[model samples]
Target: MERKVCAAAVQFNIELGEVEANLQKALAGIRRVREKDARLVVLPEMWSSGYAYKRLAALAEETPRVLEILKGLTAEKNMVTVGSLPEKVDGRIYNTAFVVDNGRIAGRYRKLHLFSTMGEDRFLAAGDAALVVSTSVGRLGVAICYDLRFPELFRKLALEGAEILCVPAEWPKPRQEHWRTLLRARAIENQLFVAAANCCGIQGKLDFFGMSLLISPRGEILAEGGETETELSALFNFEEMTSYRSQIRCYQDRRPEIYGTLP
Candidate 1:
């Protein structure tokens, strides 16, 4: 990994069941960030189609094609990117985030925790494993919307040599504080970088508050977006993370033997 790398997140309005429109928007956002020399980019969850439950199966069918497009773009720009799309596999639908690094599919993280409050578990099959993969940029840990609430998962990723965390979400209003606090807490506790993308605007009955963020190991907000369609970019310095970790000695002082290991 380079000592420093540029990362970005894209936020936009996801129209329900409008695969083509949403795809074009995502592409535009990716290009915009790439132009600014961002070697890694993250997009919002279910970006190709909002929570159009009635057309979810059909929408999921487009994920492969969309991924191909992303692969080509990443290769052309020499970038690594991640975003969530509805995936249909073996007749089961899952909210899956695909990590594309330089034209290859680096890894996939199916959302493990479905938001039962919104009936997500009823429609989508949950993922059983977490993802921490090596990419063109660096080692990355991936998580979806609801997965952010689970600190254990993030801790596992950090312990497993993940240097940066990428989150793709479609979080709605009335809980913006939770999003901000949890993201910072995850970075601070794990002593790594975090880049999260969230959609903005209204889709169906839900309104999304776009506050995509890029945070440092010290819980500093390097870059952030507002409640609108936009892109936020920041440079992540691995040396800074190493310095902070050495100074804090959090990992060195861990008592996993007494507290039990994380799965």
Candidate 2:
């Protein structure tokens, strides 16, 4: 793994069901961040198509093309990126995050936690598996949107040797604190780096607050985006994380036998 790496998060308003426009915006963000020498990039959840639940199946058809373009871009730049998109398989739709590394598909993590309040469970099928995969940058653990609310998943990722957690989200307003706090807590407790991307602006009736964040193991915010379209970048040091883990000893002190074993 690289001792230090530059990571970036891309934030933008997603046009409902507009694949081409969203693709262009995401590509532009990636280009800008790459110029800053970012080796890894994370884009917002369901970027190619917003929560167009009625047309999710139709919109998912364009995901393969979007992935192909991303493959070409990562291959040319020799970088890795992650973002969630609608995936259609066997007539069922899933909110899946694709981790592209140097032109190849590294891994795909489906959204395990669906926002039932928004009727997400009605439209999308839930994922049963978690993803932590090796990439050109380092060991990456991937989760999407509502998964941030579940600390157990993050703990599992950390225990499985994930160096960085990449989260792609479309979180809305009136809950920005929850978004920020949970992300930092996940990093501090797990003692790893976090790069989370969230979209901004309005999509239908929902208003997204784009506070994309890059957090260190000590829970320090490295880079943060405002409530608009933007890109945030920061340098993450593996040595720093290792040192913090040694100092805190959160992992060593854990008594899973009493709390219940992680499945």
Candidate 3:
């Protein structure tokens, strides 16, 4: 049996410290894709609150409010949604990604790799584990912006039976090439579909280039957005991925014993 699902990556401009306006913009982007029959929708990292680390304490929302919006939207539309935001829990902050399925909070992933260049290390506590959540859409793995640079995380998820990987990023304009290359590399190497949602517009002195992408298991660009506020979508077939994996057999040929000496 071939399982297939429609997925969308939403790209939008976020206002710094304006939670209400940012929420409205995110919801509007989701609504647009929902009309297109997207069963799984992904929003950019910090879509509700901008990535203004200096004002993180004041801008970050409690878990309740973020979940309420995500769960409500997913339940109302009967779809799955994934997005990252700044969460303040137990007097500590973490860049977390929440997976909402049919209005319920199915899973949460705190970003393990914090981007030091952006001062994420100073403002947020790093997550200790990788998150792979099982949902109606498929077995999905979640990663944040900087986490995409590490292939080991994606490989671990692949070994754990993840069929699709979703990444929400606030990737900047200067490193846009790295963003595109890394995404395609992850999909190709892991032999799974990769969907990345990135934000646009300027935040303080930094500018974000919105090139949200959906890449296939074979490293093909199925859908891609330009440097603007838009939504990119595509369909993923699990059966095709299965066939490719069987043919390649990359996972079966790993020499873990010899490569265990690193670090």
Candidate 4:
């Protein structure tokens, strides 16, 4: 019963004050996802620092060390892994998405949209590049935390031939409905696969809703995890995306001229 395109999400309760314990717990989930024959595995945002971006610079992870751990894990498990991490680059701390596959750091995506309303701008440096990593499974476009709120980034990725979108987020409570609504809307509109990995439990003063989802191109909820530390696993069909795009044909029927008509 091995599937070529199996996926899994780790919805873990990240212990806010215990980074070591959280890392250990999350490593276990990554291994579990591999054992289930998942070609792609996702972990929640800031699974290491627990969304404590205010202290990110002081506790930020080095690119090499994080890359080493993930490289080893992915090499041993032979699965693609993605999630958020606090990264220090060029003397600036960024909220980043680390992508590991086979035996190397495949790619990294930094959060472009700083959640200024939540004071993220005070802590983390925003990224400018839109990252899409190529893997054996497919081309994966990654966005971290608050980057999920931007439709333009996703559109650019779709145009760049990305088939699967990975959104690793620490989305909070009281806005749980928005999370689900936005995820489905993104999937349906883009005609691509969506895999959301969300953190559960409290970080500092914020509580995250861990209802991570794996959505089909047609916006069908292929698999979903509840608001707990659990795993959501499913097998996805790659052809469904192409089929939906052809049938919907929204991209073809675009009014690009009106968007930039030279008056």
Candidate 5:
């Protein structure tokens, strides 16, 4: 049986190298989203670090600390939350994101495609496995930051029964068009709801594109934010994704059997 769920996307700014302040800001957004009766809240990538990609050594938190805190938020609000954070695991550093559901971690996905143009590969390690988790809302697929540019990732997730794709990003201003176009393509082609939460304002020298968007299966932007902080909430009907997929049969038309080494 399918359930009806409301999703909230929190678009906000963060303090560079200040986890305490960012968490306070993010916590306020969480409370606000809960007040609005949303069952899930989405936050931007590396939000706790203000997309301060340079300060991983100083601002990065232990993975356990992140999970311990988000557990309380999920339990108290009775909802799920997702966002990316810089991780320190077993002495290795990774740019990663977590999906918290029902008071515990549903799963975590690492940012596989590091943007070398931004020198991300210089500081962080790329992740190997794709994360797909089954939730009460639906099967959720997670991709952080640069992962949005890769359509094949969404295709694989769609093939795995993912009805909703959560993208937590720190996309800067210059590439706003790419962000919007790629996000919509992912939603329309995959026949899934795309909830993309991006940071607003400037983080160090880079300015973010604040068009945090929640889109429908038909590739329409149901809600979009401007160049400021906002918690954009919208209701999505999973039935639409299901109905479109059944009618169009996009998945069935795939010729994966003859294809090899798809990105």
Candidate 6:
């Protein structure tokens, strides 16, 4: 049996350091998509607390209010949601993405590669592990903004049976080309779906390019957004992805022994 479902990526304008306001905006976006009966929804990184780290430590939430809200939303709407926020855990802060499925916390993936250019390395602790969570939709691999630049991470997830890679980003306008190209390349090379949710508006001096996208296994853009607050949705057929993978046979032809010796 082939499984197919509609998924959405939400793009919004995040106000810096305003946790409550940001939460409200994110909730509204989720509700708007639920009205259209989207089962899987993704939000950009730092949607709860905008990516201004100087004030992020003060704005960060130590409580699980964000998680609780997501749990309730997913349960009420019968949807799965993926979003990232500043997490204060045991006195350290992490850029963490939470997977809320059917009113429960499915898993959390912290940003493994911190953006040194933005001083993320100084403010947040980089995550040590890659994460893939199974859901009714499919096995989803979660990654944050800069993680898209690392193809190795996506490759590892695809090899581990990930059917979809959900990237929650706060990508800027200056590198919009890199954002689009990297996302398509990841999907094409890994032969899986890539759903990226990015933000709009500005945080300090950095202006975000809100080009949220949904891509197929063969590097096809299923849905895409522009530089505005919007939601992009697309239907994905797992059977088609499987058929494409079988035809390409890229995974089966891997010469792991030689490649593994490089590092």
Which 10-residue window in model 2 sums to the lowest lDDT? 254-263
TM-score against truth, every candidate:
0.98, 0.98, 0.97, 0.94, 0.95, 0.97
- Quote model 1's TM-score: 0.98
Rank by TM-score, highest first: 2, 1, 6, 3, 5, 4
lDDT of 6 by residue, 96-167 (tens): 999899999898999999999988899899899999999877799999999998888999898888989999
Candidate 6 lDDT for residue 9 = 96
lDDT of predicted model 5:
0.84
Q: Looking at candidate 4, what is the lDDT of residue 2? A: 28
lDDT tens digits, residues 1-263, model 3?
A: 67899999999988888888888888888889999989899889987777777778777754468679878888999899999888888878888899999989899999999889878898899999999989989999999999988899999999898889999999997998999999999999999999899999898898999999999999999999998899988999988998998999898899899889557
* Candidate 1: clashing pairs of residues: none
Cα RMSDs of all predictions? Answer: 1.3, 1.3, 1.2, 2.4, 1.6, 1.2
The CA root-mean-square deviation of candidate 4, after full C-alpha superposition on the true structure, stands at 2.4
Q: Give RMSD (Å) of candidate 1 vs. truth.
A: 1.3
The best candidate in terms of lDDT: 2
Candidate 2 shows a clash count of: 0
Q: Write the per-residue lDDT of candidate 4 for residues 58-108, one digit (tens) a residue.
A: 657544565687788889877888888888888898888888888877898
Show the colliding residue pairs in model 5.
none
Model 5: how far is 110 from its true place, Å? 0.9
Which digits, one per residue and each the tens of the lDDT, describe model 1 over residues 127-175? 9999999987889999998899999999989999999999999999999
The regions of model 2 sitting more than 4 angstroms off are 261-263
